[model samples]
Target: MTPPAPSDENLLPAPVLVVEDDPLMRQRLALVLDGLGYAREAITFSQSLGEARAYASNNPLAMALVDLGLPDGNGIELIEELRAQDPSLLILVISAWSTEESILGALRAGATGYVLKERDDLEVSLSIRSVLRGGAPIDPFIARRILALLPVAADHIEPEEPPRPVEAGVLSARESEILELVSQGLTNREIAEQLVISRYTAECHIKRIYRKLAVSSRTRAVNEARQRGLLP
Candidate 1:
């Protein structure tokens, strides 16, 4: 018997892997991927950690949507393993668990985006797109929840006042400009476009900013800047 050829959409992009335990949710997610213009063959669905691990070992996935609660083991373990294997993988957590612990743990485990299954499919697709573009896509509600859990006193403590005008030499004018845009939540691509620079140049600036500030992650970089009175 002859099998039908893969669709045009499948040929347009790299594969996206879905590691979910629920059969229905798996199908729903596949549908979401389809809505994002990915063909069936471009989406690989796994119902357990073992299957996902095997597939990941053999395939180079462009992105992965993982569920935390798996039949074999917690999905965090799989996320950590995958991250250990490939640090550049864009892993998003799509689970019903939205507790602070689950969200924070997923980020710590190298998942770039933590999306709850309750969110509509459109939001999920948007989050996938955001992660693909190197933008961190944290759900607004989840962001609030995480913020509420932070120590309130930290916000009340005012650090020593920095010098007025924050010496231009503190960070190169271009680096400071890039940091400001970063604090505004702009992705490298958006920053590049706004600054009329290439994405690679913007990314290079961000890396230098991270190294100079001795911080990683945009959130931390922003916080460091505020502490130093570089931003208002």
Candidate 2:
């Protein structure tokens, strides 16, 4: 007889580490991992970088969800150490710090994904899932902020002329409406509610807007739209 195949939950990577200082945030992350089919016993939670490092030294981790502001030190240092220990390890930074330095530093240290703590649980869940799927999920706000710093960083270079306005027909009417709501900082869920559509529908419209504007993040889409005079 053929042996029974393992379920998806049983096949999930084990010995996951979550390095976070806040008690509430730790609990929230624990719940998120649990909902994602990770066994409670397979998950380890540490509140400081020191504890996390000690644990990492002893155990081979498959994945880590790290926070930037640890009680003992910055999470960036830990990320560097973890990456050095296991190049294949999946590390996702779930941090409150959003400065350009923080964002760039974490990425340079080999974090596979960077998600802001301010994001709701749904957003965080999606990011974790993306990591599991071998995708790097960056926060749109972080992406936008990083893009804003590029021109300033290249101050010595001559500035190029302003972007030419795209044709008014570039975006469909519904896409324009969705982009406007996005500029207002609405989440996909909020946009769906406002437009009386499914969250998936709202997300699809936003993706179309991204394609039309040639921007990958929501902030960049809005900035591009403004530059092209698609939105006032």
Candidate 3:
């Protein structure tokens, strides 16, 4: 069964590790975590991969926000190491790097979500919160980039008959509406505001959508919906 969605109350006691070389970016992430109800003492900041590794060795972490470019080494290495350490750890890549290699590498290395550093504070906060809530939140630009590669990837596959299109009525009208908002990169809170529903209700709809789609992450759900003709 799918786990319950995480809330601010549950996240309050979970420790978070932030690995970023830029002082400004580190401070910004710290502020975001604070705003999300993470205590200052519960959040740990490391300026280099070595420091992050050091902290990880001695402490248990619930989540980690990492950057791709670091002073000591690529952050992907740290991500791999952390994932090896704790399979349940929620890792989100928050970096200026948007290259296809960097993006795909992070995901393959077990990042739960990936967002560009160029996104504004609100977008970053939403992505972080989504990760905490067991949602995989990819930046819109990143999502588009991944989608653009789908056809290219399919080119290498052996020819076969086309698959049947997904039935439109497989999802309820309300579920379809929620999926549309999700495809537009809206968070549950934003979706709730847009549809005049409570955030909890919005989350329930999203979980139902995920179940129907047989996908665990928002990015996968949107991609599956589009492949099945559920979205434009």
Candidate 4:
């Protein structure tokens, strides 16, 4: 006898909306979402933030895959707008770049997660599912950067106070530029525009900066950067 086939009726597909500007990227993203078993309705694609908003207004989106730079506006701004409309919605930042400032900015703006489009294959899909399930799926390298940024002072097991304020060291010119925009709380897409670089390039730089400074969180990095006279 043949094995029984699965029924679509038994399936619960999550509604997804993907917003990206590049045509090839947009279509490719839809394919990824489809592979995850989401409905075509669940995976609407738009090249601009404006179109995303329009779609969201008409249909309830369970999740969103947003790029940093859209033809009309920054996708981060849409995250804010969508969150305002539906607090329960899951907003994930998907872009080529992952600037230190952009990551922190989106988190502050109420995004539920972040993913790099450069590697949005199986790893990215699993990550999205993980975030939706209450896991904070940080990239391994990102995790290390975050861990470095964590305060050295352990829990109130009363550790000895530092004898001197150790300087975290000044950021190089390129790193400083990245940090300044972070201080302004700009998203990676916005930062990329300000600095004129590809989104992928921006993210790579952030990862490097994190490793160099031995800091994890953007807040810690920015604070330390300021103290070291790295930021103006």
lDDT, candidate 4, at 76: 77
Query: Which model is ahead, 1 or 3, in terms of lDDT?
Result: 3
Residue 51 of model 4 has an lDDT of: 88
Give per-residue CA lDDT, model 2, range 1-232, as digits (tens).
Answer: 1222235753565568999989999998888877777667778889898899998875557789999998788999999899876666789999999988899889878899999999988788888888887999999999898788778867644554442333333876778888889999999889989988655456656755675677899999989889888889
Sort every candidate by TM-score, greatest first.
3, 2, 1, 4
Stretches off by above 4 angstroms in model 4 are 1-13, 149-232
Provide the lowest-lDDT 10-residue window in model 1. 160-169
| Model 1 per-residue lDDT tens digits across residues 164-206 | 2322226677888889999999998899899986564576567
Evaluate model 2: give its lDDT: 0.81
lDDT of 1: 0.76
How many steric overlaps does candidate 3 have? 0
Predicted model with the maximum TM-score: 3
TM-score of each: 0.60, 0.62, 0.63, 0.56
Each prediction's Cα lDDT score?
0.76, 0.81, 0.81, 0.66
The clash numbers for all candidates, in the given order, read 0, 0, 0, 9
TM-score of candidate 1 to 2 decimals: 0.60
| Candidate 2, poorest ten consecutive residues by summed lDDT | 1-10
Clashing pairs in model 4? 16-42, 96-199, 96-200, 97-199, 98-203, 145-216, 146-216, 149-215, 149-216
